[model samples]
Structure formats: C-alpha cells, structure tokens
Target: MTATRLASVVLVLLTLCSTAVPDVARAETWEAVISATSPDGLGTATVHYQHLAAGDSPTAEEINDHIDAEANRAVTQAMWDGSTRRPWTFDASGRLTTWAITVSEVFTGVYNTAEPHMPMNRLGSVVCDTRSGIIISWDNLFSDKTAGLTRLGEQLETQVAAVASPTELRTWRRSGQFAPVDVNFKYWIPTREGVALQIPEVQFGRGLKVVIVPWSAISDLIAPEFLPITG
Candidate 1:
C-alpha cells in the first residue's frame, strides 16, 4: 500500500478500537434483591436492595459491602421488640441508574413517631455512586452545594405551602425540619421523574410528606455525573 493509504487504514482501525471500548461510567452491573426478614410476632421487615452481581471492580465490592450492612441493619431493626405491637412497618425500595443506586426507606405507625411529644413519621435513604462505590450525601449531588441547597429550600417551601394549611405551615416552620439543613433533608433520592425529598414532619396528625424537585428545576443545580438518569 502507498504511505497515504496505509495511514488511512490505521486511522480507521483506531476509530474502531475507540468505539469498541466500553464506557467506564457504566462499567458496574448489579441486581436488586427483594427480600424480607423471617416473620415474627413483630412482623416482617422488607427491602429491595442492590448487590454487585457481575462486576469485579473494587468499587463494586465496596458498594456490595455497604448494601449488606444496610440490609442487615434494617432487618435487625425490624425484628420484634418483644413487647410493642403497633402494627408498624419498615420497608425499603431501591432505584438504580448507570451511575448511582439509591435505597429509600420508610417507617410507619408507632415506630415512626415524632419527637418532643409530637407524632410524626420516619423517612430515610441511602444513595451511592456505582462507579466509585461512594455513599453520597444530599450535598454531594450538587455542583454548588450552598446554591443548590438554597434553591432546594425554596422549592420545599413552595411545594409544602401549596398543600399545607396555615396552621400546619406555621408549625413546620417552627420545627426547623423544613429548613435547608443537611440533617433535616436526609431522606432524598433521585428518580426518573425527579429528585424525591421527604419531610419527616409537617403537621401533628399528618404522616410523612414527599415533594419532588423536578428535573427541569434542578438540572442545573445537580452535578451532571450524579443525575441518576434511568434508561
């Protein structure tokens, strides 16, 4: 072959090689295990959890370990306390994307009662990066933590106000749970529709409440890498 023709062939080979390479971002593969603890008088605690089933990456191993530990904790907690039969329930569901996995947990009835003589509900979540196997915090989803959280607080107020009565709104604002603080906003996970934010208490008699920050509202606030875009 002439020099120019040989160069052209090499270019084509390189292009093919590049395209054939797998995307490192989606390297991890996992399976969700829907399980429950052995039933006792207390009742069964259930979970939909993810385990790294096919990947050999170190990050996958770490993520698997976290899943096991979390599942164990949930199962143990759900076991009968041997006395209290409040007909309460503890359950978890897992959501997955190529880059992240989130486990959203809920507790209902007596077990999830509010603090300080108040009656509220419980909400929790665990979000982990599939690539690095890192358990990410609510703040970690944002490119600018302060700005994102501020906007999140604003969204919370807007959504909650729409549904809350004047009295309920006043009480929630007093409790500080409606604030933008990290601890107050622990129960959140990204879903296909939007990012789900859970409110532990907004009213005395009312149970837990959830509000979604739509992708349209937060597409710029969250880091693109952590978007949890479903297939």
Candidate 2:
C-alpha cells in the first residue's frame, strides 16, 4: 500500500476505536413511572418514582409499596396539621398547602454484589441488588469509610455555607442547624455535575434541604461502583 493510503487506513482505525468505546455517562438511564396518586383532600398527594429498565429489578409491587409508604406519610402529616390549624371557618377552608413529592431516579449504575445487579440512583435508591435482594446503604458506597465520611462532611459544610445566607444560617442555628456528621446525611442523589446530599425536612420543619457539591470536591471518596453515574 502507498504511504498516504496506509496513513489514511490507520486514521480510520483510530476513529473507529474511539467511536466504539462506551461512554458511562451516556449508558446510564432510569425508567420513570408514577407509582401512586391520591387526591382525597390529603393535600393532593402524588408520588413519581423511577427504577432500572435494563436488568432484573425490584418488582413493580415493591416499587409501588415504597411510593405508597412515602405518599401516605406526607398525606398523614398534612391531615394532622390541617386538623390542628386554627380558624375553622368557610373563608379559611381549602387554602391549605398541597403535598407533591417526586423522586427522580438520578444516575443509574450497577455494582458487583452476590447476584443480579441493577441501576441504583438517589431519591428512591436503596441500591437494592435484585438478585441477592440486599439493600446497599450509604456507607457501603465508599471504599474508605472514615475518609469518605470526612470528605462528605466537608463538602456538605461548604455547600451549606455557600447556599444558605447569613440570616438563614442564624435561623437554622436556632431551630435546625446543619450538623456535620456521617450518618446525619443520607441518600445522595447523583446528578450531571455533582451529587445532592438529602437531608430530611423533618429536622428543620421545612422542605427537603439539599446540599450539592462538585464531584471533584469528593471524587476520591466515591466508590468505583458509582463512578459511572457520578462521572
């Protein structure tokens, strides 16, 4: 073959090789579904959930049950508050706030376990290994537990300081201070740029408090199993 012809062939081969390589960011996906909905004056409750669509996943029944439990809790809380609210008059009726909780199955990645593995994400992820049926907790997602905890704590603190204003922080300190602890924050949601640390609103008597930080800030703490999605 001619020198130019050979160079062209080599270039074509390299292009093909690059194109064939799989991108982890592109490979991750989740199947979204409305697990439950109830409008019986319980603040118009609705729960949207997501799961793995690729592999053997937790059954629909299981997913629905999870959604139902979360939905019911919101409804019950609203009902209790409504009953206790003052001013029981015609003008004061139907003005109560509604409940709408949506769980995004953000970032689906599979990890090695006993048996079949599936996509697991934040919001509704238990990292439930469908085959072995074992729920992977937040602690398990890190290779070095102590180091991971420290890294996560720092990231969260920085995010809170950056997002929460001075007034908000002072108010929070009085009623709901953000405690830097390992177990205090749970269920992290992986997004395109970073992960959102999920802190229950029950602690602060408000909506969910999310602390998002860049992956680079805590990249060393994240396990290889989650790199595909978190990347």
Candidate 3:
C-alpha cells in the first residue's frame, strides 16, 4: 500500500477504536436495605430503597451511604442537629414492603415569665411500596401537651412529575376524610450541593389560590433530610 493511504487507514482505525470504547462503564443497580440507629441509642429503624431504573439494584451499604449523605445535607442546611432511626425491607422487585420507627428531635423555646428552652422529641414513619415507587402510608407523633389534642394530623399523599432537571411540580392532598382539600406545590430542586430546598410555591385548596413565601419562613418546618432524587 502507498504510505499516504496507509496513514489514512491507521487514522480511521484509531478513530473507530476510540469511538467504540466507552470512557466509563455504567454501574449496575442493586437493592439496598438501610438500618439507621438513633443517636440516643434507644431505637433503630430500617428502610429499603433501590434505583428507579429497571435492572438496577444497589447494595444495602451504598443505599445507606446515599441516605446518610442526603440526610446530613438536609439537616445541616436547615441548621438542625438531628438524626433518624429506621429499618426497611425490600422485595425482589426493589419495592419497600415495610418501614418502622423514624424519630427526630428539635429545640423548642417556650415563653413563660422568661424564655425557657427545651428539647422536643418527634417521631414519624414512612412506609412505601418500592416496586411501584409509591409511598403507602405515614404517621407523625409529637410531644406537645394540650387538652384533647390529637397527636395524629392529616395524612398526605403526593404525586410528583419532573418538569425539568431543577424543577418538579407535585400534586398533593390529604388522604381519607380531608381529600376534598387538594393542593399543588412546586419545588425547585437545588442544582448544586449544600443548598437546601426552596420555599415551595403553593396553590392551596381546590380553587388553586397561589401563595408565595420566603424559604426562611418555612425552612425550619420543612424536613431537611429528604431531597429530590433524579432517576
């Protein structure tokens, strides 16, 4: 072969080889069972999670690490020092079949003759069906003392749709008897690390009345531990 033709052939072969080779192989998904121990050492809770994509299962250890990272980011940004405990079980389809006993704490300031500060304890549970990517049930227990106060409040179910990489629109409503009051909340997910959740833009009631609030106004009330996951 001519030298010029041989050089062209070698260049073409190199280009094809480079194109065929991937820089990084895709990671396989695995199901993960995470058990969180409470900071007080009083209890532990477990949760099962898997990647949303099909044929992806992450190990329990990986899931636990991801949960810890997100939870830490959430709490730190909200300026709260709290932890959670839970145990979760997953089915073969990568759905969470059971979850139990997740507790959190916060500092509360009570006004009497003077400002008295106290630590408040709160407990909650998040149950979900991992296969369907649906949360089945949840409950919250609060330590506030009042006459005839109902510890359990409204049960809420949310359906979320990602409109963009950084924006998600959600339809949420209270389950059971409170179903009549449906609302829409829009979340702007952070594109960078260390930023917390923004104040959700709420369209309240069936009539869809829009209300906007500052992120700081509800930052303390929002759960900092859970952030949106992109599939």
The lDDT values for all models are 0.54, 0.39, 0.23
State the displacement of the C-alpha of residue 178, model 2, in Å, after optimal TM-score superposition. Answer: 4.5
Query: What is the C-alpha lDDT profile of model 1 across 1-231, one tens digit per residue?
Result: 234322221100001111221333344344444334333334345555444443446765576576556555544544533125344445554443432354332323233312244333434455666557777775577889877777787788788788769988788789874566786576666666677776665433456767888777877877777765431
- TM-scores of the candidates are 0.60, 0.45, 0.20
- For TM-score, candidate 1 versus 3, the one ahead is 1
lDDT of 3 by residue, 71-163 (tens): 333222222222223221111112221222111111111111111221222111222223333332111111221210111111112212222
* The best candidate in terms of TM-score: 1
Model 2 clash pairs? none
Top model number, lDDT: 1
Model 2 agreement with the true structure over 81-175: per-residue lDDT tens digits: 32222321110010101011112332221111122221111132333322232333456656776676677766665666677788876766555
How many collisions per candidate? 1, 0, 16
RMSD of 2: 20.0
- Of candidates 3 and 2, the better by lDDT: 2
Q: Worst 10-residue stretch by lDDT in candidate 1? A: 9-18
Off by over 4 Å in 1: 1-50, 75-122, 201-205, 224-231
Question: What global local distance difference test value does model 2 have?
Answer: 0.39
- Stretches > 4 Å off in candidate 3: 1-27, 51-68, 71-231
